[model samples]
Target: LHQFDPQDVNYNMPSVLQVSGPLDVKRVEDVFCQLIARHATLRTRFELIDSEPMQWIEDTVPFAVEYTKVQAAGTTADTDQDTTTDTYTRVNIEAQQLVSRFVRPFDLQAAPLLRVGLVDLGVQEVEQEAQHLLMLDMHHIVSDGVSLEVLTDEFVRLYDGEELAPLRIQYKDYAVWQQSEAHQEWMQRQEAYWLNTFQGELPVLDLSTDFARPAVQSTAGDTIEFALGREVSERLKELAAQTGATLYMVLLAAYTTLLHKYTGQEDIVVGTPIAGRPHAELESLVGVFINTLAMRNYPSSDKSFLD
Candidate 1:
């Protein structure tokens, strides 16, 4: 056995989860610096997240994150979450590139915060407003959607002047634990389900593209999204009631059926993004807890979307 390699393979990419109202750039910068100091993982850089063969910019001090000056510009949003807008361009060149280029590069943390421009609303919205932008050029190794929760929470705790607690463990250990308990039960059930359902058939898909040979493994790299309005959405939900299944499960079934019709496959395997939130303590930490599972669809002869 080759014991020379420290065991970690997955890496996280820098992502801007959301855009907030404009804030004091200085304060926002302070918050990030403090967060990094506390979370050594954030401070320490690997050419990747694990002890990978890469460069990690351990210190990002003297970092100045730019903030747009929003005037609020006399706008009212119906939802409390929504803020009025007067637009201007914001850019985080390096930060943006980091997400797209999921590989190593020089000066990783350049342009750390992806920008969402600001507006002026005079005293109504801009006053006493420490509108801040939370910028994290987190390496994929250290930040995943689930672990991000942890990172954000710790940041808030430290900012609020609370004594920050150390993490129960590191990201590396979690990866090892994940592979250990392989939940063979789930695997066996899924395998049996597929083997019986499509013993003599193929996957069902009506995809117009290269269904015979997909161009890429990850559709995330190129997923074209569409929105459904409330009326159609409600209609689908109502129809989904017949299966006594969730809207998501029902939708996947329908999609699988369509794919089978198109591809002439009786059994289907779908790639699904699952949030690996198995642990409660890791909730507030920012790391990669996102795992992908191939969902097997073994549809019987009778079920339809409406059914």
Candidate 2:
């Protein structure tokens, strides 16, 4: 985020969590605050010290909740239930608005880079229950996809009045340990292997494009959805099993093959992201534990899919 322009939205990670159940505003607020208090990463901030980046976790950070109520026509097919239709429509619109507000960029210096919003879905007459949508906005600097899941599970447990056991170590502690002498020695042992693997100059991939590339890349992007047929899925699995390779490796190899065909480049490099948690104990920690590794695959014209 620091490398990009101030207004760039590259590091924003907005998540919308919709739940249909009765919600007590005060209880929900308390639970949300407790969730932030429990995780040190949520309260961390980055700063420059002598031209080097460093992290510091605040003892406590401010937490606030914004609430909104809406009323609109509903979309239920029941012609006689006019009121029900309006309630459902209102809920849907409000939920969308909440999500829109959640995706805005955050200021790194503003510690406790998290925001929470609540939408009250009045009441459901049939069940005599209330529904709600909880939206959370976070910066990618401190949290990632896996960390969000960890937060959700803990939030549920805390809301149920279950006390959580203390964490073995916080993210900051792990950061300090990574730079220690013991860790450096361990890393030094593998230096020769990495040097040998990446000895040559890396090759750049030149993909054919219909349109000219922009001077500066845009952060705006959308997801493309596609589905694999059951037969194809099974075939891929069988091929992976026959070759003693995992499904991900099989898929990656196929991707490399496509690039080789398109660009006609024998030396191809593809980047894949991996969960960087080296220790079993780090699995439960909520923080940025992701690393990207470049895969250099040399595909020959004679190589078959199974090979």
Candidate 3:
């Protein structure tokens, strides 16, 4: 998807960590280099070989941390009183801008599709210590949510000078196994299941939108964050347990109900991600191992929630 549409930034995953107190820039840089050395996915790049995309891992890749010093936007008249406030506001704005810049499309052909930036906010009056922001930008082709968590845990351990256990297999090993003859039967069974499930004409979801649908699908969208209060959350979990269904199933059922209410359609299809790691060995590895599962449901007014 990225190779065809190089302008899309949806696949870019950027995260920021706030660091207080004195920071060792050299040590941070060395930690990132060590992480890249440890994960084959960090050193892997894709290229077109015989009209097909093929990924190859390099023995090593050069890594660097881009550093920026944040200063107050302009001089304030009340230097003593407002200096600290002004400096903090400037740091926040710069941090936002830095994150915006970091969330950008990556060149798939480039090795090690990960980059880091460090923003240095000079010593603060309250903490009396320097502040820094560590920004990490990675392409989704080589990572997912689990991979991020794995990277963070390993980063902390490596930074603390703790030794990590050697990995028995890398992502490339999984890829090779997936294409091997031994896995053919399992793959064929899965393929057949999906083919049989959607054998006929698929229904198109036509929920009302504020604006007319565009000619081409867009990857652009905004996120709305909300929290279901603790009471409601616990009730939902209880309901899931009572019904012998997982919390995800209960939530998915409610979601489909809402969609049915809006569209007045009985049949609905939703896509959800599943961690594709089927083996314990693949759990701690950092790579893209997520698969989308299309769930089809039928909602009816007469049927109860349990049905």
Q: Which candidate is the best by TM-score?
A: 3
Against the true structure, what is each candidate's TM-score?
0.55, 0.87, 0.92
**Per-residue lDDT for 194-267 in model 1, tens only?**
67865655554555684555564542455589999999899789867865778997778778777777766656
lDDT of 1 at 279: 77
For model 3 the TM-score comes to 0.92
- What is candidate 3's lDDT per residue for 1-307, written digit by digit as tens? 7756798878888888988888889999999999899899999999989989889899988788998887633334455656667666767887789778867778888879999989887775555678888888889989998898899889889988999999999999998899999799899998999999887777678889998878998877799999999999999999999999999999999999999999988878899999999999999998999989997788978878888
Model 2 root mean square deviation, Cα atoms:
3.1
| Residue pairs in candidate 3 whose N, alpha carbon or C atoms collide under 3 angstroms | none
Best by lDDT: 3
Residue 258 alpha-carbon offset, candidate 1, angstroms: 2.2
lDDT of 2 by residue, 1-307 (tens): 5655656557777777767676777877899788778788988888878978878888888877887765534433563586775666666766786677667777787777887788776665544556677877778899887788888888888888999988878888888899999999988877777777677888778789986777787767899999999999999999889989999989999899999899888888888888888898788888999878877788878888667
Model 3 misplaced stretches (Cα beyond 4 Å):
72-79, 125-128
Residue 91 CA error for candidate 3 (Å)?
2.3
Candidate 1 has a TM-score of 0.55
Better of 1 and 3 by TM-score: 3
